[model samples]
Target: MNPALANRPGQHLRIAALLCTLLLSLLGAGARAELQLLDGIAAIVNDDVVMLSELRAETEMIYQQLLRTQNQAPPRDALAGQVLERLILDKLQLAIAQRAGAQISESELDQAVAQVAEGQGLSVEQLFAQAAADGLSRDWVRDKIRNEVIIGRVQQSIVNRRITISDQEIDNFLNTNSSELLNAEELQIGHLMLPLSSGTDEQTIAATREKAEALREQILQGADFRQLAVLHSSGQNALQGGDLGWRAANQLPTAFAIALRDLEPGQVTAPIRTDA
Candidate 1:
């Protein structure tokens, strides 16, 4: 080592020691906080236990997601009543699922996780990385998926065998709700979106447009469009393979209805954008 550099090192060594101590303190505090959060179960539904921290975490996730969807600032107490109702419902369903001994296998959980990733146009690894980045454990996502599958299976078992959507019921409902439901169509179509924004630098816009065009080209090259939609579409129906289920033509935005009218099954179209 250079003699001058070696002589000046004590200050840096002290700073490094201080930083290590601070880091350890922060870690200790974080662990303590986590222990406090899960110290006890806040509620019991039948044989199932609901931890307070788990309920708060889930409620916060749902609330934040709803806020983003609405593109509005969420009220501090926004829909407090509704949120409580949902939590109660969730508890009831979870209890029922536990009683039925409904279980989700790792394979099933993986498939559900894959579907969520595909819906967001992400690979499973990427999705897991994102969850980690969000300060969420991969196990948390898996447990959520497990509960979803169990509850869904239980609900379906209860309803599917006894309840039916008959053609007669559909016809009767359509007649009774003619103004709201008649003259509607469900379009089965796919698209690639490229947004134009003045705030975006020209180079970024061009690159985004290029990616969008490439996606469209791949779609036309016999790449499964539904699979692609499950992976990449940004529209509301992205999770459902871009399926905009049947609704009255007049109920949709005028521009969207026009586009729907112009589309045909198994046909692809150039990108279209408009405000609703």
Candidate 2:
């Protein structure tokens, strides 16, 4: 300490006052709140950010499906957070694929797209048109498809490296598990949904069926199915224009799967009763 300043009590008080003033200035400046008006990120992976709106969008569809399936679900916020974990996992898988140099060639991707289109009974252009109607561009769909393929490759590689089995073990496992492992098909589906409320009389149910028939006709006549879904579907996912996305074949209700099996992709089922 400088002897001159140390001897002066006034100097000590002045120094303490200066420190207090500086602390107050910082606090006051930091206290100002900036309002955010638009969407922002829900979570950040190493090289990717999952947007808040994206999480909400994904969860809303799942939430609707749960209700339609007669299953209890958590609150929207809880569902979104849970779904965010899945997004993070996908991001991690993608990063692993990138590190491994897993690649999907353009021709291979093109063929995959064609297969999906053909399976749906749509031309490639029609598939792109449907994707556009749902706010996804062809490039975006391609990129997503590419990422899925890469992740599958990387995961298969990881599994191959981790698992070990002798011929005897393989034979025993196959003998034990073969009967349990019945083959099942998966279906990627979309719906233009309408609900049938309970306690409705037979007359009302018939009327609802008639309405559904009319809409189905319009769809067959080339009216946009998504537009009709937005206008008439009672589903919470009506806002998404009634996309059911994808589900495993066994995941679908048995009756619905049977009905869906005969209908080509992009074809609307007659307004089936919600109770059905």
Residue 46 displacement (Å), model 2: 2.9
lDDT of each: 0.65, 0.71
Candidate 2 vs. true structure, TM-score? 0.43
lDDT for position 241 in model 1: 46
Q: Write the per-residue lDDT of candidate 2 for residues 111-175, one digit (tens) a residue.
A: 88888779768899997887676566788667766776777788799879977879997887667
TM-scores of the models, in the given order? 0.45, 0.43
Candidate 1, 130-162: lDDT as tens digits? 667656688987887787778778878987877
Show the colliding residue pairs in model 1: 118-230, 121-231
What TM-score does candidate 1 get on C-alpha atoms?
Answer: 0.45
RMSD (Cα, Å) for all candidates, in order, is 16.3, 14.2
